[model samples]
Every structure is written in structure tokens, then in C-alpha cells.
Target: MGIYGFDLLIAGLCLLFKQITQLSYVFSFILLFLSGSVIPFENLPEIVRKIGLMLPLTQGVLLGKKIVFEDLSMSAATGSSDFLWLVISSLVYLTLGVLGYKKCEKIAKEKGILSHY
Candidate 1:
């Protein structure tokens, strides 16, 4: 998760994405926007919030807000409904995203997608 909740997990994902694309800058903007990294999840449209849940950052931001603004403790948050979603989403995003990135990297290398760059 982007939570940096686990430093190793985030570092692993960065490696996965870097392996798949040379467009980290562009991806940063997309992640920031779609993951609610820069905005509140509640403020997002219904469809977007749904999609945003597929990205780890959204859960991270939500959890962060709960800690900072709501004064929720780490242990308490881990027991809340929101934390349940965060855990579920983190599992889904990290597992699938890493595997998908590996597959894309293989295909992209075979196709020479970035050979010229």
C-alpha cells in the first residue's frame, strides 16, 4: 500500500511499476488523482471512489486522515470497518498489481515498446 504502512511493500510496487513503464511521472499524476492522494475519498464521485479502492493509495490516504484528523489510534483503526476495507483493498491491489506489472513488463520487453526511448 502507498501507506508506507509497510516500507517494503511500497518499494516492491515501485519496482514493479518501473519494470513495466518508463512513464513514472505520468503514472504519478494518475495515481495521485485516482487514488484520492490529493483529495478526500468522500468528495470523489461514486464511480471513481469505487475504482479508487482498487489502488492502494486511496486506502492509505483514508487511513491517514482517520489518524490525523479523527485522532484514531493505530490499533483502533485496524479494528474499524474502514480498516477492514483498507486491508482487503491492499491485499487485492498489491497481489494483482504486482503480477500484472510483471506480465506487462515481459510483453513490453518482447515488443520493444521502449527500445527507442
Candidate 2:
């Protein structure tokens, strides 16, 4: 799940780069590590932990680990409200990423930064 989310973020950032500067491979790597690390959220300072929990990648990694390691049945995995929230978060990330890319593209066009392709 971490890998999947990392790939998605990379794809999104790449798509967004034409419109935004300071977004590069290093930033993507940092975000990916933040999402995949297993340090307990509660062990972190409160504000940082809250920010971590709000990240979609974190949610994906947690829920993905549960689904992969547990003996939960399909219904138990998908029917639970918590899992539903994870699904929603994943969708939200995907949708927002795409929309952000589009918005950035528009801004780049206005700023005459778009590359001919």
C-alpha cells in the first residue's frame, strides 16, 4: 500500500511539476517515508501526530497492513466503518491530486510556463 501510494504521489507530482516549482523527487521521497514509517502516532508530539494521521498515505498504510496481515474475511474488511473511512480517504487523495494537477496546469498556462508537448 505504501508503494502504491508512493507511486500515485510521484505520478501526481510529475504531472503537477509543469505548473509548480520546488516540487521534486526529494519531496516525493520525504512524503513517501512519512507515510510508510511505523513509529506510533501517539509517541510523536501531539501536533505532528495529528498531521500524520490526517495524511491519506498513512491511512492507506495502516489499513493495508491490517487487511494483509489479519485473518479478516472480506466482509469484515470492507464492511467495517473504519475501513470505509480509509477507502474514502484514498479516494479523496486521488481526486484532490488530479484536481490540483489540473488547477496547476491552468495557472501555469496563464503564467506562460506550460511546455509544448
Candidate 3:
């Protein structure tokens, strides 16, 4: 689940930076793997842990692990409330990525960088 959201973010970024090297997919894969195995947020310091929690991958991994390890029922694992939160987080990321990309494009256009396109 976390990987899914992370993939979405990376895909979005790739779309927004199509002219640049397409590394988001690989980067997201590495990040997702790290999120799951290397530095589980539980092992992080307080502030770093909080920052980790804000990441979509973290939320997805936590929810997924709870379901897989604890035998939590789907209803329990993806309760309406919890699902809504996931949706909200995804939407927020999507919105921010799109707006930021648009702003960058606008700046590039104003600076004539976009003329080459």
C-alpha cells in the first residue's frame, strides 16, 4: 500500500519532469524498500519518526503490516475512517505536486526556458 502511494507520487513527478531524466520510478522503488525494511519508523528519533509518519509510504506500510501480521480483518485494516485518511493524504500529495509543477512551468515560461519545448 505504501509502495502504491509512493509509486503514484513518483509517477506524478515523472510526468511533471518529462524533459529531465526519468528516475522517479527507480527512486520510489528504493524508497519503498527502505521504508519497509531498513528504517522502520519505529526505530527513528522522535522528530524524524514524525516526519516519516507523514509520508504516504509510511502510512501504507503501517496499515499493511497490521493487516498482514496481526490478522486484522479487511474491515478493521481498511476501516472507512482509515481509508478516508488515506484518500485525503493521496489527494493532498497529488494537489501539491500538480500545483508545484505548474508554478515551475510558469516560471520556466517567463524565463524563456520553455521556448525550447
Query: Which prediction has the highest TM-score against the true structure?
Result: 3
RMSD of each: 5.4, 4.3, 4.3
Segments in model 3 whose C-alpha atoms lie over 4 Å from true places: 1-37, 115-117
TM-score of 1: 0.63
Ranked candidates, highest lDDT first: 1, 3, 2
List where candidate 1 sits over 4 angstroms from the true fold.
2-22, 104-117
Cα lDDT for residue 29, model 1?
73
Error of 2 at 76 (Å): 1.1
Cand. 2 TM to true fold: 0.63
For model 1, state the Cα shift of residue 44 in Å: 2.7
For residue 88, model 1's alpha carbon misses the true position, in angstroms, by 2.1
Cα-based RMSD of candidate 1:
5.4
lDDT (Cα) of model 3 = 0.62
Q: Order the candidates by TM-score, highest first.
A: 3, 2, 1
The top-ranked prediction according to lDDT is 1
lDDT of 2 by residue, 22-102 (tens): 555566555655565646444656766666666677666666677877866767877887677777776776666666656
Better of 1 and 3 by TM-score: 3
